[model samples]
Target: MQQPASTLATLWQIILRLIEKQGLDAEQFSRELGISAEVLRDPTARLPSRLTDRAFAKAEAVLADPAFALRAAECWHPSNLGIIGFAWLSSRTLHTGLKRMERFSRILGSRFSYRCAMEDRGLRFVYNHGRGDWDVGHAMTDFSLSILVDMCRTNIGHRLEPLEVTLRRPEPADTSPWRDYFGCKVRFGADEDSFLLDGETANAPLPTVNVPLANTFDAILTEQLATVFNDDIVSRCKAFLLRELTSGEPSAAALALALCMSQRSLQRRLAALGLTFQGILDETRHELARRYLDDSSKSVTEITFLLGFSEQSAFTRAFRRWSGMSPTGYRGNSAFAH
Candidate 1:
């Protein structure tokens, strides 16, 4: 696989803004992260992902702040994404804009892939990091999702509250910031990182749609995607699960069929990669369970049905196994804590 590089222009702007707000020396921090201060002047230049990651790590360490990502996101503008952002603004609907963004996400950051799938409840915008043992940075996740939400709000011309927000990182001690920013339930320690937009909100026509301009950008993004063909199986499975999850929990055989492969072949491929089909199913369920549980709009019984449990008792037992508490108890605890 080709190594990923981030365009320095956007990153440089983010760094300078953070420095200005926090009263830090831009040159000193650039040197600390092995980034050339002069590189910030080149609009078309790129920085390797390793160097970018180091800079983010140093920012968290020097500032002694866990919410550094959140702060960065608040400053993010659609124009920061360059052409992709322009495409989103020109899109005819929130759905179209999101689809465009998801399609060309690698152009923004090759380390992550974006996928959008429709479910009974709404649309899920998933962010999957590339295969690696590298430490995942919460700040990057926060910044990315926040920028998505901000873009959606701009298009819709109103505050956009997601149905649910999920993070791969464990729940922080204080989730008030995330809750405040998203204006909805936030879940952590999920199988993957994603957020859900209510079906109605997701399907709503955007105020800024420009059919001609959107078509122009679409053509450009399609060409970009063809040049960087990413045939990632894990991302494909997650996208499938996002669609079929509400309908029912898919068995390995069903999933294999959905992926257009024989069950044996699927199992063999997963084994080669040191993974199992059942493990993926379980992890997906665990992640969805957290999201469903956090939504006050859904009752435990409704959640059981949504999760594909045959009965509420069975779901409660599984919930206990996952969280060390009964379904009701877990819900109550979350409510009290928040």
Candidate 2:
């Protein structure tokens, strides 16, 4: 299933707030992205992840700012993340709050994933594109880490600074914005994207820490997660596939492994739901192919790689079967339609 609409609203809340703060017209900006002005108001709405991606691109283009993520972080508030934000705020320490964020991160979106773990430096807070891997570009990686720092500053203390920051992307022409914002050593072209904090800083009690309240929110979040995943097997499968697709081509065996089920059982489960694994996989590819084609920055070859096609010709053939046109033709049509 697609990510909940409320998650997209959080992203828009940050982006639109930054736009307003910069003296830009939020409504006009929404129009530029071909979205409704009131899109963020409805909490139950679900939006295509590609729309969120386009909005980020739009903000970057309009503002001509490489520090767009930093600006958005400045405008971020706890409420922007809804229940997960509150659950985080009520945690006993920065480490607990981060753990809460990682647990309930699905409420944010399937497109983004996070990990909070211990590393050689200390407790490392790693944020990347895929949950199990790091394949996303710099724009999203920067925004995620920056806003996380914003969250830390808000809950722990404004003076809080991480031990070190590592990014997978190459260094930009100017690194001052990142260094100034992070207030630490920012390493680029690293093997992974992560933020390292000393053990003391991570485990230290927060000003707003409330164990009882945090427990209450945790219970509620647990219930919500159960309902979301148990409500539909198809949705759970779609979400899993979306995250795993970037690594390589999806297979029934791999999906079964990810879902912690035997191959036969997984197939039985899908058959019971009146669906097939290949059917779901094809649907996912169709949806993602169209979304990627809509992005002008993503060439057909890149989209092919992203969708896990071994060859561009294979992707084109698949696209032809799905859309009755070549990948390039579909992209041209998508551009005109938009």
**Candidate achieving the largest lDDT:** 2
lDDT of each: 0.70, 0.74
Tens digit per residue, CA lDDT, model 1, 89-121: 876567767877776786676677799988889
Cα lDDT tens digits for candidate 2, 1-338: 43333344655677778778778898888777777756676554446666766766666666666666666677777777777888788766788788777867766765667898887667898876663322224677777788888888888867778899998878889989999988999999888889998887787768886655665575566555545546456766776777677788888998889778899999998999789999998887876686566456678889888888889999999889987889888766522211
For this target, which candidate reaches the highest TM-score against the unseen true structure? 2
Q: Residue 138 deviation, candidate 2, in Å?
A: 1.6
Off by over 4 Å in 1: 1-9, 34-43, 131-136, 224-338
Clashing pairs in 1: none
Q: For candidate 2, what is the TM-score? A: 0.64
Segments of candidate 2 deviating more than 4 angstroms: 1-6, 131-136, 229-338
Models 1 onward score TM values of: 0.63, 0.64
